[model samples]
Target: MKKLLAFIFLISSFAQAQYTINGTMAPILESDWVILYKIEGASQKYVQDSKIKINTIDVQGKKQKIGTFSFTLPKDTEAGSYRVTYKLENAGYVDFIFNKENLNFGFHPDYPEQTVTFSISKENILYRKYLEKISNAQQQLDSIQITALQNPSLDLKSAYQTSLNKVNSIQNEYLTNSKDMYVAPFIKANSRNNPSEILDNPQTYMSNIIDTFFYDVDFTNKTLLNSSFLIDKITDYIFYINYSDDPNTQQILFKNSVDKVIYKFKNIPYKKSIIEFLIDQFETTMNLELIDYLFENHYYKLPKTIQDQKYITSKRALFATGIGRVAPDFSWIENGKNFKLSTLNDSEKYVLVFWSTTCSHCLNEVPKLHSFLKENKAVEVIAFALEDDEFGWKNYKTNLPNWHHVLGLKKWQNKIARTYNINATPTYFILDKDKKIIAKPESLEDVKTFINKQ
Candidate 1:
């Protein structure tokens, strides 16, 4: 009986505490049978929270869906930990966002009128350290946002979530440390510096940053020698972005500014009690909303990656073709006109080697490369040649006997070599069917072995 009661209690504890979000209908959204988007991390595709029938639903009250949505303490959300994403595939035939549905331009808000703000002492080592952490954290978070911002989708949401978790953890730590009035400035500092690195200590670092950042584009002004100027500078980025012309530039600027602001307010002096106010008002309201925007940007950049996917394939094809990625694409261009990058990829199994005719290491690997090609018939060997003159290439090609071969964009200065950071003689990268890099700089045998297994 006791176990049963405990289990029941546990289940009840997991039940979501419900609340309603009231958004005034924009009239247009009211009539169309609307579907709510829990947009997928990394793109535009969204998952319909199948449980809910309508996006603008009436549980106890009427509400309208906003232009974009991110998961939060939704009114009906359950209490247990969830990895829910905002996505856009309603089984199949549905699109989450469309002017096809007819929505207006993305909303941009004006800056709120400035008024009272707090400052923390820079002299306190603990306070300085606490502030430094916040600043550092803000930078890490912002970088991730900027990286993700080239596109906005479910994957981006996941990445944003990772950053947000760190921020939340830091804020929670700050809340735990808030007994010290000294660190209270940090709580306010982070919230105040949203979308930018916190450059100032609450009491210092402000004046120079303002005099320099606001007016001069060079950003060559003196840094906060003292804590006071730092605090003020941190505040500037938060307040500034609402006024910037380009939204993309705005994201980077704000991140840089906020990192500086957190520098002065957090670290050792960080406290939990002081953090509650900031988390409630600052992090939750401003910074997080800004993160959502950046994630949308991240989603947009993925297609660029997708579009470029076709161009880069062979070790040489990828680097020479100008399809440079963290790891170049999986590719090949052999069998004369019949062979192309896409065709090689269709088989999903291949070893790509980028080498030069003049490369001694490449010369040594030739017979071994042929042996691998012979042994692993299922796996194709794509050998890219970096031959300055066609004569050396032809000679090297004739000598290479059987593995695939092709001349690169500029021989030694080939695009593939530069892109893959291959200043050396020979470079190798193995790829999976999904076009992800499995290994690089490995031996020809290692690459062949991998392809055979695949």
Candidate 2:
């Protein structure tokens, strides 16, 4: 009976075991809370969240406030990469390996990833050391190779060989040591492909580097996908490797590199995730042409289940308002007669100005615009006023009788405002005779400059 009871106790203890992640931020973080997430393929699953506690501490004989937070993992938590996001602005977060082990670390909020110091967790510590050593070795090799290419007469074969040997030695040691570990795949995927022989020609060396960039990467590795490694690798290849002085040439190079990247992945889900990431990157730069290319070529080809229909519609709406595309049609009642923006043939050029009575800037600029366009008979001004009520607009429009006036109720929630994606008042869109957008002016002065130039 005693032996049986002891075995039962052991099993109970094992089943009840839980891990914890404790974080410390010096010069106290601005955020009041921190959230923990388990990183899966292309998304993060919420694990837990904690309210941060601030405490004063001594740092080199000076008092400093530090923020601390902790997250206790559930007993059945899976082993993989985890993220702690303390704040949303400026990407205030840190990612680390969690393999059913307690982790303790500290970092500065401003530079979380760069300033992080691990006090515990063998996996994180080992991974950090491996990255530092390998990065140093690779930098040395690159420096030597660049020097050799720059000065062809000077022999750098011995230096290049020494640096290359160091990189290989570090890579092999980490690969062997991290065997069967969660971080093993990351180290393997991050291995640099060094040239076997030094090439005097820069073009040849660059070509070789680009060709072997993805030699060690396994696109289907779940662990790598869950982390930021694959996204980072793809970003470097598409943006950094492919460059040109001319903007048109750069766009073509980017497209070619994107093709090479997409061809490497056979898994549909992984491919979709990568393409989505690329779309987001281009969206930030407002590269509408590339965005259209991605949707037409890659995103549209994906399965319907993965396709985001709402996002597709929104993007199409944006394209509809783009320069050279006909503006969305809208109708309004003026003098008890319906008038449509598309059917207006009375003027050679139309100025669509979205303004609000409550906006101080709009109040200041609209009068100036009305005065300036009074003498210009060829240009017709469509003053669309976004308002909550007709009281102020009815009284305000008396002074600008020559301009066609349209009232948009519901202010920002107005259909026309939403259609144009208007966030601020006094926004101007200059349209040609065909009602196609020509110039999106910033101010009344810009409107004058554009009209005067024409």
Candidate 3:
């Protein structure tokens, strides 16, 4: 464990952040002071306070005075998406200092007057905005509902629907016309009344857009889809997306790619639905055994939530994907061109190192790895950096010795991380001549030991 900690530490430039919290609301006679610092792309921390804030409420809920504290983001702080997160000792809620705009794109709320507009370049970003809009809009409707207690004439849903209608108009105009697949689904989902419809009936609504309907998702269609349509459409979509490959808009089509299908699909029917589908399909369809496909076969899809999602221990047993298990296939661009990885022929084995400059461990391990490769001139080490940071990774590239250096991926949570299950830093997996897993977690000692044994 100490070695593992040391090894992971090699990836760090040892940067840290500091902040000061100050304010007052009430007295804190019993609760302990808790100062927390949260960043976007990196981990958050709790530390001693040198900042200020309204005195937290005590156990007895008495009035208190205000005070302040301070902290800092170290000079070595890595350049990445981040934010300041905090919470008072007595308060139950956590406060976010960084604006939501970072996670979302074009998330404007009523810019100038009575109307608000939203536009997003990516599907994921659009989804966040869509969810946010729905939530906030509902809040407004809920507020109006308060009047219903007295007059019984207030229609809160009608009030909220009005706001959604305007949003729907914007979605209809942009989504259908755009080639972006997210546009269509997003507009379609928003045009419906509630997220429940999206969760319950993905198939029928999706199928109509593809087959029968002309794919119009404007305010014209107010009726939400039923459960039956959703299930059928989703199943068909799962298979359809699996087979079809759109070249013109190649990357964009991955918006709903069924590749990483999850258990959240069960959010609708956790109990009876999983079994019902199997029985119903078996009775109707030909040549099929009744079986729970996800849990029985592809159970990796069942994650309770994003952060604690059990794609690891619960996802069955996935090998480290070191050598065999088939190569972690990838294609990238380099030198103002394309066909980087694809150019490699499958006839021989290859050593691909997905790394980053900020990852200090890569600095130490890679050079030595390259030295070993140099001795075996026949072998190849494609050091494709997961980080595309020009200033960040480029500096490390200069000090490194001669070897193949590949780029393109800028995010740590890129395709490679997902494929390799790269939880820790400075990981080395070796492949045999046939691109089979020969060794993994090939520490410096492991490589030295293996090579000597060979």
- For each predicted model, how many residue pairs clash, with residues at least 3 apart or on different chains? 101, 0, 40
Evaluated with lDDT, which candidate comes out highest? 2
**Better TM-score candidate (1, 2):** 2
Q: Write the per-residue lDDT of candidate 3 for residues 81-172, one digit (tens) a residue.
A: 22222234323322222212222111111121122122322433454455566556555543443344344554455554565565555555
Candidate 2 lDDT tens digits, 51-146: 999999988999999999998887778989988999987778899999989999999999987899899999999999999999988998999899
How close is every model to the real structure, measured as TM-score? 0.33, 0.87, 0.31
> What number of backbone clashes does candidate 2 have, counting pairs of residues 3 or more apart or in separate chains?
0
Candidate no. 1 TM-score: 0.33
Where model 3 places Cα greater than 4 Å from the true spot, the runs are 1-323, 340-343, 346-348, 399-402
What lDDT score belongs to each candidate, Candidate 1 first?
0.44, 0.89, 0.44
Inter-residue clash pairs, candidate 2: none
What's the CA RMSD for each of the models?
21.7, 3.6, 22.9
Which stretches in model 2 have alpha-carbon errors above 4 Å?
Answer: 1-16, 322-326, 329-350, 356-364, 376-379, 385-398, 401-415, 432-454
Model 1 segments beyond 4 Å from truth? 1-122, 125-184, 187-338, 345-348, 416-421, 432-437, 448-454
**Span of ten consecutive residues with least summed lDDT in model 1:** 108-117
